[model samples]
Target chain A: MEENKKTCLHDKHVALGALMSPFGGFDMPIQYEGIIEEHNAVRNACGIFDVSHMGEVFISGPQADAYVNYIFTNDILSVEPGQCLYGMMLHEHGGTVDDLLVYKRNSNDYLLVINASNIDKDVAWIMKNAEGYDVVIDHRSDELGEIAVQGPLAEEIVQKVLGLSLSHLSFYTFGEFTIYGDKPAIISRTGYTGEDGFEIYTDHESTRRLWDELLAAGAKPCGLGCRDTLRFEVGLPLYGDELDDDITPVESGLSMFVKVDKPEFIGREAIIKQKEEGPKKKVVGLEILDRAIARHGAEVLDADDNVIGTVTTGYRGISVDKSIAMALIDARFAARDTQLKVRVRRKVFPAVVIAKKFYKKSYKK
Target chain B: MSKIYYAETHEYIRVEGNEGYVGITDYAQKALGNVVYVDMPEVGDEFEAGDDFGAIESVKAASDLICPASGEVVEVNDALVDNPRLINEDAMKNWIIKISISDEAELDDLMDLEAYEKYLESNPH
Candidate 1:
C-alpha cells in the first residue's frame, strides 16, 4: 500500500487536536472541535481550510488555447485573462476524466487546478492528448500550497488579516499578489461552499504563516468534514461521487459548464448527442421522509421495488436539519415532487424528489 | 441496588431484580463521536440474547445495537429520539430501553465493571 501523503498543514492540524483521516490519498483533518460545530461556523462566520492537496498544472505555449479548448468541455475563449472557469476534462467516450478549474492567465497561458486523487491520471491524460500541440505542460502541484477562507465574513477577514485589497476582484476572478517579499501568488474570489470566500495559493512556508494569522485573527479552523457538508448543502458535485468514469457531466446536471456547441473538442460528439436526445440518466435531489439517512451507493427503488438508480451523495443535513441526498436516476423519474424509495441499510426509506440545492447560496455578486 | 453488567460489544445493562435498563457504555459513546440519532426498538418487542435490536448513528457512520440478554422491551427512551446527543452527554444515565429480563442466566456471560474497564484498555479506537 502506498503511504498517505501529508499536506504542509498536517502538523498544525495535529497540534490543534484535529481528528485526522485519509482522503484522496492524503492524511487530512476530518474535523476540529466537532463536525457540527465547524459546519455551523462556516455558515455563520469564517472558516479556514487546508486545501493544499489539490493539484495544479500550468500549460503555456502558442497552441495552449487550442489545446485546452480541445481537451476541456468549457469554452475558454469566452473568458479573458485573470478569470477562472470551472469545467471537466472528458474521455473520448464522454465519461469524465476530472472536473477542474481553468485559470486564464492569458491567451497563451492557463492554469489547470484539479482534484488531488486524480493528479496522476489527469496529468497522463493531458500529456497523451498533447502529442500534436506545441504546448508545454508543467505539473506544479508539489511546489504550491492552498488555503481557502470561506464564509460571509471571508472577504473582510482576508483583506484585513492578509493586508491584500480585493475590492477589484469579482466573482470567479483572480489576481497575482506578492506577500511578505515572497513570490507573486494567486488569490481568487471563488469557493465550493455556498458562501462568499477566497482561495489563496502560495509557497508552503507562506501558507503556514497565513494559516497561523487566520487562526489568531479568529477564523475557525475547519476540516474536510464541514467542507463536504457545506458544499453538499449548496448542491455542488464532488468528482468521484457525482461524475465518474461511467458518468458524464451532462448526466450529472452540469451541462451548463459543457460547451456542446464548440466546433471540435474531445467528447463533443457524445455530449451533443446526449443533449439532443436527453440523457437517459440524470442527477436529482431527494428528501428522505423517515429519520434514516440515505448514503452513497444506496439503491433507489420505484413503487414496485425495482432498482431505478443509485445515490451519489447524502447527509442528515447539519444546517437544514433534514435527511437529504443527491441521486442519479433514470431521467424519466427525475422530475421534482416524484415519489421514490431509498434502501438505506436494513430499511427502505420513502423519499421525494426535490430541488438539489437544499440550501440557498449567499454569494456576493 | 442495581448490578451493572457490560457486553463485549460495549452495551451495558443495569439489572435491578427482573427489570433492567440498557444503554451503551461511555467508552462506546466516546468512540462514536457526536450521536445524531438512535433507532430504538418498539415497546413489547421481544429479542433473543445476542440478537440485533436497532442502531445508533453518529455523524460519520452507523452501528447496530445488540441485545445482550433475552427480554421483552417494556419502554423505549423517547427523549433520545429528539435528542440523541444525550447519549454523548451521559451514556450510562441515558438508557435506551427498559425491559423485563426473561433469562437471568445471560448475566453470567457479561463482564463486571472491573473486567469491562480492562477490556476497554486492551481495545482502543
Candidate 2:
C-alpha cells in the first residue's frame, strides 16, 4: 500500500500531542485538546485550522470565463473579480463530481478550490474536459498551503496577529496582499464554518509562521474532528458523506448551488429533469429521540420497520445538544415533522424529520 | 479488596465473590474521548463470553462493549443514561453493570492488572 501523505504542519500537530488519523489521503490531526472543546471554540470564540490539504487548481486563458462557466454549475459571469462563488461540478448524468469554490481573478484567470480527497480525480476530469476549450489548466495542488481562521472574533484576531487588514473583503470575496517581506498571499473572507472568517493561502514557510502567530495570539487550534461537527451543524455538506460521485446536488438538497437556469452546462438536462419530476431520494435532517447516535450507514426505517434510507452523517450535536443526523430517504417521507426511526446497533430509536439546518448560521452577510 | 480482571478488548470485571462490577478500563475511556452515551443491557439479560452487550458512543463514533465472561446482568448504572461523561471522569468508579458470574472458570481466561498493563505496553492503540 502507498504511504499516506503529510501536510506541512504534520510535525507541529505531533508536537502539540494531537491525535493523528488518516483523512483524505493525509495523516491529519483529529483533535488537540478534545473534539467538543475545539468545536465550542469555533462557535463561541476564534479557532485556527490547518487546511493545507485542500487542492488548488488554476485555470487561465482567453476562454477561461466561458470555460469555467461551462464546467461549473454556478454562474461565474455574475461575480466580478476578487469574488468567489460556491458550486459543484457535475457529471453528464447529474451526479456531483465535486463541490468547489471558484475565485474569479479576471476575465481570463480563475482559481478553483476543491476537496482534498478528490484531488486526482477532479484534476483528471478538468484536464479531460479542457480538450475542446482554449483554456490553460494549471494543477497547483502541491504548491500552496492554506489555513482558516474562523469565528466571531476572526477579523480582530487576523488583524492583530497576522498584521493583515481585511476591512475591504466581504463574505465570499478575496484579495491579494504582501505578507512577510513582499511574499504574495491570498486572503479570502470565506470559511466552511458558519461564522465570519478568513482563509489564507500562502507558501509553506509563511503558512507556518502565520499558524504560530495565531496560536500565540490565543486562537484555538482546531482539528478535523471539530471541523466535521462544526460544518455538519450548519448543514454544509462534506464530500464523502452528503455528496459523492453517485449523489446529485438536487438529491443532496443543494439545488440553490446548481444553476439549472444556465443554458449550457454539463448535467443541465439531468438537473432540469430532476427538478421537474422531483428526485427519487432526498436528504433530510433527523432528530433521534433517544440518546443513541445514528452514525453513518445506519438504516432509517419506517413505522412498519421497513428500510427507508441511510444516515449520511450524525453526531451528538455539541451546539444543539441533540442526536441529530442527515439522512437520504425516499422523497415521499421527506416532509417536515414526518416520523421515522433509526436502527442503531441492537435497538431501534424513534426519530423525527426536521429541517437540514439544525443550528441557525451566523454568517456576516 | 475485590479482584479486577481485564479482557483483551479493554473491559474490566471487578469481582466480589461470584458477583462482579463490569465497566471499561481507564485506557479505553481515554481513547474514546468525551463519552456522550452508554448503551447498557437491562437487568436479567444473559450473555456469553465475548458477546457484545452494548455500546459506548463518543461525539465522533461508537464502539461496542464486549462481555468479559458469561454472566447475567443483575443491575445497570442508570446514572449513565443521563450523564455518560462519568466514564471519562473515572472509568473504574463508573461501572456500567453488575453481573452475577455464571461460571467462575471463565474468570481464569482474563488478564490480571499486571498482565493487562504489560499487554497495553506491547499493543498501543
Separate DockQ for every predicted complex: 0.46, 0.87
A81: Cα error in model 1, Å = 0.6
Is model 1 an incorrect, acceptable, medium or high docking prediction? acceptable
Can you write out model 2's per-residue Cα lDDT over B46-81, one digit (the tens) per residue? 999899999999888899999998999999999999
Q: TM-score per candidate, in order?
A: 0.95, 0.98
Q: Model 1, residue A351: what's the lDDT?
A: 95
- Per DockQ, the best of the predicted structures is 2
lDDT of 2 by residue, A24-82 (tens): 89999999999999999999999999999999999999899888999999999988999
| Model 2: residues with Cα > 4 Å off, grouped in runs | none
Q: Is the docking of candidate 2 incorrect, acceptable, medium or high quality?
A: high
TM-score of chain B in each prediction: 0.98, 0.98
Fnat per candidate, as a fraction, reads 0.06, 0.82
Tens-digit lDDT track of model 1 for B58-87: 876688899888999999999998889999
